[model samples]
Target: MSARRLTLLVAGAFCLGACSSLNPFSSSNTKIPALKPLTAVAKTAEVWRGRVGSAGRFVFQPAVFGDAVFAAAADGTVVKLQAGRNVWKSSVDMPISGGVGSNGRLVVVGSPKGDVLALDAESGKMKWRVSVNAEILAAPVVSDGMVVVRSADSRLFGLDPADGKRRWVYQRALPALSLRSSAGVVQEGNAVFAGFPGGKLVAVNAINGSLMWEGAVAVPRGATELERIADITSLPVLGSRAACAVAYQGRIACFDLANGSTLWARDMSSSRGLDQDGRHVFVTDEKGSVHALDLSTGSSAWKQDQLAGRGAGRPRVVREYVVVGDVEGYIHVLRKDDGSLVGRLRAESSPILADIQLSGGDVVVQTQDGSVYALGVQ
Candidate 1:
């Protein structure tokens, strides 16, 4: 899947931020409000830093397994960091983008010319690799001893985690832009729930790729400005009760986990990804606006344009703050309730917001330049 842009409302004069800037909350274009100096709720101190080959174009999101951080570089290298320390960095022949997964062992997906590799988590050694016909953009979801991955060809493949053997594969009717919607697999009892492009929500049997239920979701039809760069470029965020999905030019909707039915839908014409805090779902638009909505009702609780002037990043909830990276390589920490800027982590300059995760109370971030850094309180 391609990178998903944040949802923003661009009515104000400050909205001119570039799509490539690093700060998730950059005020480069718009005169930003005087932010109250951030109190030390969380102090970010750099733990360790490491570089990958040639400073590639994309940084695959990092996945944490126990005390180690697993990251895939643009040069098709997978590096392991143990507790903020570099363990090993292994290079493959092809460039890869998908995130990491594990069944009994660690598994990761590569590119159009790459294979799905199952490696030993403790040692960075490859166990087996399954060749695929398409590129893998989304992270492989692991469940029930199987590694589940969605390919650019609108196909879902299930492989044995132990040996990288094919368990089952399901092909769906995908639109031209369906390759951008990363497959999100959620296990509820015996059924596996995954989202698709061309506005589809499907439920498949976990044991086999048999279809359980399929339904069409509400796609966005808005102004031409919204449609130009609009598409569901992120994986569906699975909430406790519902699976939430945001589209660049489509509507944000929650589907029932039991059956592929729409529970609540919100029109986010320029939105991309959805992050939840158990009760509320957080999202952003292309114009640099962030919104908090009740997960159950899909009603807006709060909306803020603090990241005005430009918008791009996936908002990850860390503790009481919602952390999102911008086009300007800075990570903005916002209060979860009303969208107030709490703190900012100035990490990289040309940062691509891949995926951010917290392990052991420290923030682990992967940059587009194939660099990984760990930050935490002093």
Candidate 2:
């Protein structure tokens, strides 16, 4: 072959490899197994299914407030549903990139334009709007009379629920290259917990924004930027005595909720988050394996690997099963005690990206195409 033609061929090969590594749909690295047809073993039925505009790649889940559930779409449609009926539907006139946070009295959402808008929960009327100057990819959380928001730039802001006035701002310098996803902030009593790019988890006083404690769940150690990208992108699962977090290329560790002391650490990695029940914590790892760890010690209870390389979301602990959604719109229910696949269902033809939301006795799933389904098991 000619020298120039050979060089061009080599460059094209490298480009294709890089593209496949980054694309979630690409099965070049690992072949995604065909979904096994499930025979109906559990009585599963859809309680309600609805669509807000197309969500595209943005992650938006429903937030429950008393008798109402609030959800938003990428095209700016927000709806309030109760008892399988839409109470009200409205639009913010701008793309909503984050949120569904509500406290019954006020509902909050964030935009790509850095605007945080609050609406009256009763009538879907705009209460207040404020700017934060950065894109918000995670949902805003309302607690302790404050609405907490985390910007994509790693700045955490506390705003007054009454008028969207800024209460406090916490800023941290971010690494040059880091994971852009966040599990948002978890609030408990007076403490607000959030994860950062460097595998760090911080606890702040929700009332005053003062640092309560900071702990490292995982430490970055590799040479390349991709290898050293240890980001704590998942929501920390809070238990009675401790809180646990997982890092993308790092470890899963539990910290004392009262003082942020490391309780136990395990060398596990997951881009998605973790969930905990009374006895165990469930996490979906980067390879699409789901693990159940003991709540007291971080010991492994069980691990399931049938969905590896299938792009699974975080696991949600339901009544007696752990439910997870995958890229092919399949919902798999595994027995919590043994991690055995017991039931399965399909929500839509699109990918299910957001974590499953549990309401009452039903689980709510949101797809990439903006379909929301309330599934119940009988």
Which numbered prediction scores highest in lDDT against the true structure? 2
For every candidate in turn, the CA RMSD to the true structure comes to 6.2, 5.8
* lDDT (tens digit, per residue) of candidate 2 on 1-378: 986455445433532454332234434656678866666555677788876767765788778776677889998999888865889999999999888788788889999989999989999999999999998888899864899998877789999998889999987766545655636898988898999988999999888899999899999988875567688877888888888999977999989999999988989988877899889989999888999999888899999998777788899988888889888898888888999887888867788877788887888877878777789865
Q: Distance (Å) between predicted and true CA of 11, model 1?
A: 28
- Residue 99 in candidate 1, Cα distance off native in Å: 3.1
The models' CA-based lDDT, in order, is 0.65, 0.82
lDDT of 1 by residue, 1-378 (tens): 322212223311112343322223334445434434667454566788766543343336777766677777666777787765777777666777676655335747566554777667667788778877776766777765567777756678888777878889998654322223333455666666666655556788877889987655555354544233334556567766677777655678787766768888866744346588788888876666778889989999888787764444667777777777765667777788878876777777765567676777777787776677877633
**Best model per TM-score:** 2
Number of clashes recorded per candidate: 24, 0
Question: What is the TM-score of candidate 1?
Answer: 0.82
List runs of model 2 lying over 4 Å from the truth.
1-31, 37-41
Model 2 CA lDDT for position 222: 86
